[model samples]
Target: MQLTGMFVHPLKSTRGIAFERAFAGKLGLLHDREWLLVTPDGDQITARSHPQLVRVRVELLPGGILLHYEGKPPIFAMTTVFTRPHRAQVWKDVFQAWHGDQRLDAWFAAILGQECRLLWLGAQSGRALKGGGEKMSFADGYPFLLVNQASLDDLNSQLAQPVTLRHFRPNLVVNGDYPWMEDEWQVIRIGEVEFDVMKPCARCVLTTVNPDSGEKNPDGEPLRTLVRTRRLEEGVCFGINLKARNEGMLQLGAPLEILEQRYSF
Candidate 1:
């Protein structure tokens, strides 16, 4: 199969930046989830709790980022270097992170209507990957998430109104012939980078949100359907989480070569 799509999420829960190619490192993609929104307690925030986050359009700058949303003035948050560092928490993992400017923090506070701060997970990150060994950005669990287009197509065929790939928020989307072929892939290589298909990614309520509007599915759809078909002991699983074994440049349309296959089922 071929790699058809590539994306980077600079900030957690915000819009993803589509790219033709990206540098892959320990964190999967460079600048991916390097910054994040967190409470004063360092707890991470997401569209699952605050759906408005998806409404924020993010454009990566030469240094910082440009954030745009409806009915609000655009704001630019600089990442030159965080002066005030804070303990940032994602799930149960906590690490030292730099807090953004009050203006940037206030921007998010005003938009979310809560006292939230933006934290940067730069090269100084200390949090270990879920299964141990190596560090990562503020990405949910693993360094990368992969989905097959054919699998999404299969899912769309079963839905009344198909959901977009944005809802699933995958980092790498591959073009494959059969549905759910990724379930059996243990290792895959795109260009020069090799990734271990760590485990099945547990789907969440965030998938029900409309990526364009930040509105949730009123009927509790995709999640409900996935529960009926893709449910696992962990949760409703759709995509696969990945950890890069080697760093390199990943380009779209590159052939996805599987080195090993072992089904969890």
Candidate 2:
């Protein structure tokens, strides 16, 4: 197997940026999910609910991020050193996270036509993994999400319209020989980083939204087909959640070494 793609979503739910090389840290990729849009009460505003969010594109800048939307001027939100802790929530995991620039918040509020604030997870995340010890950013659950290209191809064969890897929002995409081969992988190494395959990623309606147009597929395609084909004990799964065992640089075309695999059923 080989590593084929690397991606990072600086702002949760917005368009993601593809990378040829990225640093694998404890909290997944370097700038992935560091920024998020939330309500005044701290609930996450994702593309799952607000499809318009997918229209916003984010560029990771040196000290901050650049936001781009159609017909609007690109906005730059600088990251300031935050000392105060503000309460925020991602799913059911409520924790103290830092708020971003007020100007950025206003920009988002006007775009979404709803009351919301932009938050930064700080230089280091305060949210701990469910079991404890390791910390994660604003990702739904695990630190990293891995998708197999072959698996997607298999799903496309059943679909009327094909979707790219962006729809699922994975940090890493590997080229494997067979479909769903990742299901049996327990441990794998990419470049200098080794990751523990944690669990099958339970997909959601967000996959039904077009990453480019931000419109829902009226047919409810891949997700609908996955329900019939890929449903496991844990929801409809299209990818695997991963936790980095060690930190290092991950480059495209890196060889994927399987250190361990699950026993055959």
Tens-digit per-residue lDDT, 1-265, candidate 2: 8999999999999998999989999899999999888999888899999998989999888888889999888999777844457788999999988885777778888888988988888987889987869898999999899999999999999988999898899999999999999999999999889999889999999999999999999999789999999989878999999999899998999999999997656
Which pairs of residues collide in candidate 1? none
Top candidate when judged by TM-score against the true structure = 2
Q: What TM-score would you give candidate 1 relative to the actual structure? A: 0.97
Candidate 2: lDDT of 131?
Answer: 83
Taking the tens digit of each residue's C-alpha lDDT, what string does model 1 give over 207-234?
Answer: 9999989899998889989999998776
RMSD of candidates 1 onward, in order: 1.5, 1.2
Deviation of model 1 at 68, angstroms = 1.2
| Poorest stretch of ten by lDDT in candidate 1 | 122-131
